[model samples]
Target: MTLDELRATAAARHDTCAQIKKMIVSRLDLPIEPAWITDDQPLFGRGLELDSLDVLELYVAIEAEFGVALYDSDMSVFGSVSRLADHVNPALAERAPTGSA
Candidate 1:
């Protein structure tokens, strides 16, 4: 791809990550602002300090907000903001109305 196309892709990815951060903060009633959450920061443990109950809440919120069902048994997607964004954005794209993309 051309440099312009690459930049566009990166911009879109950044926008999606920002949107995901906002969604997480809003849905979880986080004390921190969305902009404060870096994309690579761990979602649980030492990073955001989230717990199992928070994970459950996140699952529900993600399903309701993004129309993506998250299984609690699968923790791979919860590793970081970027991971969640990677998982959710495609689901969002798929749920978009036909011909929207």
Candidate 2:
């Protein structure tokens, strides 16, 4: 998987950053600016609005969708959508190319 692959996968699920932002805003009942949830802004506390529980849910969702096992450290990588994007881009890149790798 590559960045483009991940982007394509994310887009297919309507689960990309922009889509997730809308979901979070509606789900959390948050007062947010769509512009504020950039690819890099922290997604909890000072930036977005998720807490520990939300993190867990997001992790579950990500794993379920991507078939990836994210460790604790990887969880920290998701501090912001952009940060998560950083981790995910590389992870997908290193996925052994399915049967080829």
Candidate 3:
């Protein structure tokens, strides 16, 4: 699985940006992205309104959903939604489509 495969999977299951935002919000238990979480915005710092705790939650969420173990130092890699998509893509590629998420 590569980043391309991961993006393909996420896009396929998530479909619209709104749906993708909902999936992230629900999975990570964040009151975020009521609209669409822009692919271009940072999901960290004061950028997309995320804090370190959110990153911790995201670590858990990513581990659970994609079966990828994200290191504490690796949090920097997930700064943006695009990065998260990149980080999680290969792992997702290994999983067979569960059908419509």
Candidate 4:
């Protein structure tokens, strides 16, 4: 791909990650800014401190917002914002950043 094409792809991935962060914060009513969440930040356990309930909420929110059903997906899909981005927006999978999950 050309330089502009590469940049566009990166931008799209960044946008998708940002959207996921916003959705997480809004859906969960977190007290932090969406930009504060890094693309590779973990979504559960000691990372975001999310629990199983939060996962259910995220499942609904993801479907309503992205029209993607993640109910049958495993926990790895929620490994990180960038990882989630890949599932919600499959076009990014080919160029997904390292350590996303």
Best by TM-score: 4
Top lDDT hit: 4
Per-candidate clashes come to: 0, 1, 1, 0
Judged by whole-model lDDT over C-alpha atoms, candidate 4 comes out at 0.92
Off by over 4 Å in 4: 97-101
lDDT string for model 1 (6-100, tens) is 78777776887898889889877999889999978999999988898989888888888778887744676887787787677774334333232
Better of 3 and 4 by TM-score: 4
lDDT of 2 at 13: 32
lDDT per residue as tens, model 4, 59-98: 9999999999999999899888999999999989977654
Candidate 3 structure quality by residue, lDDT tens digits, 1-101: 79998788776534433443565789667665545577656777766777777777767767777676776555556556655655566453345332341
Local distance difference test, per candidate?
A: 0.79, 0.59, 0.62, 0.92
Off-target runs (Cα >4 Å) in candidate 1 are: 91-101
Worst 10 residues of 4 by lDDT: 92-101
Model 2: lDDT to the true structure: 0.59
Ranking by lDDT: 4, 1, 3, 2
RMSD of each: 6.9, 7.5, 8.7, 2.2
TM for every model, in the order presented, reads 0.81, 0.53, 0.59, 0.91
**Candidate 2 clashes between residue pairs 3 or more apart in a chain or in different chains:** 39-82
Q: Candidate 3: which stretches are off by over 4 Å? A: 1-20, 31-35, 91-101
